[model samples]
Target: MITLLRSRRSIRKFTGQKISKDIQDLLIEAMLRSQSSRNIRPWEFIIVDDKKKLEHLSKAKQHGSGLIKGAALAVVVIADTNKSDVWVEDASIASIQLQLMADSLGLGSCWVQIRNRMATDELSSDQFVKQALEVPDNYSVESVISIGYPAESPKPHSKENLQYDKVKYGSFSKPFYQD
Candidate 1:
């Protein structure tokens, strides 16, 4: 698992290949099994595969979104705020799980943050996704994950690139990077 974690990289370019139902189910299962605060699991997944919808979603944000149009599918992670106070954290965990699972399945995935962000037209990113997907008002969009077969291969993060300087022994004052 550590190796997998070390090698995982965000894939922003994808091929025209399609993902099978089994793979999609596995990714969903990963999210469903993710740990959440108090185990409330106050999250929902919205899968968008339609080309036009994906195009619309690509425009939902000004940047870090164009890749969705090439991805085979996009998973919109959402949470019911009323169901859990830590809904954002819960949804975020699930999103990472989904990305990791995609990597395990030899697929590629990248996360596009939506919560507390704005679209190109000044509309809230969450609201834009809700309007596009017809999501209920009770739920808030946390992120949108684009998944597909990668077109560009990115090298895994090397140990030399690790930010060990950010580590602290016990408290913030003891940071490894004295400077």
Candidate 2:
């Protein structure tokens, strides 16, 4: 499972290929299996396949550039604000699950932030996305995920290149594990 998680990378480029319905259903099931706070499961998914809509979304949403033209499908994961304070956490888990499932199924995926502070302000990175998608007032558009076959393999980040010295134990400056 860790290998699968580690192997999963954000795929911005995709082949212009369509995914099967059965695979889509399986991905949905993976989302459903994600754990939520107190079982609230305060997440809603909107799958977009219409070419026009996808194209419009690419211009509207943050990090949606490659999604519109490359991905076979785009999913909007919304969190019900009225549910609980942990709604965002729940939605995020589901989003990761969906992405992991896509990777396992030999598909590529990338997450586009939609409900962050940057995406909602006056100088929003994706103000047009909210209006274009017609997101409801009651729900927060947490993210947009693009899924499709990869056009080119993404280079993996090297673990050795990461700064592990900054990591600490229960207290600051205390090493958790010595190199």
Best by lDDT: 1
> Tens-digit lDDT track for model 1 on 1-179?
99898889999999999999998889988999999999999999999999999999998788878888999999999999999999999999999999999999989999998988889666888899999999999999999999999998889999889898889978887986665
Q: In terms of TM-score, which candidate is strongest?
A: 1
Alpha-carbon RMSD, each predicted model: 1.8, 2.4
lDDT of 1 at 37: 93
TM-score of predicted structure 2? 0.87
User: Candidate 2, residue 58: CA error in Å?
Assistant: 0.6
Candidate 2 per-residue C-alpha lDDT over 1-179 given as tens digits, one digit per residue, 9 for 90 to 100: 87776667899888888999999999999999999999999899989988888877776534445465567999878877898798889999999999999999999998887665353345453355657777776787777888999887876667786678788999997987686
Q: What value does the lDDT take at residue 33 in candidate 2?
A: 94
For candidate 1, what is the TM-score?
0.94
Compared with the true structure, all predictions reach lDDT values of 0.92, 0.80
**Model 1 score (lDDT):** 0.92
The residue-level lDDT of candidate 2 at 1 comes to: 82
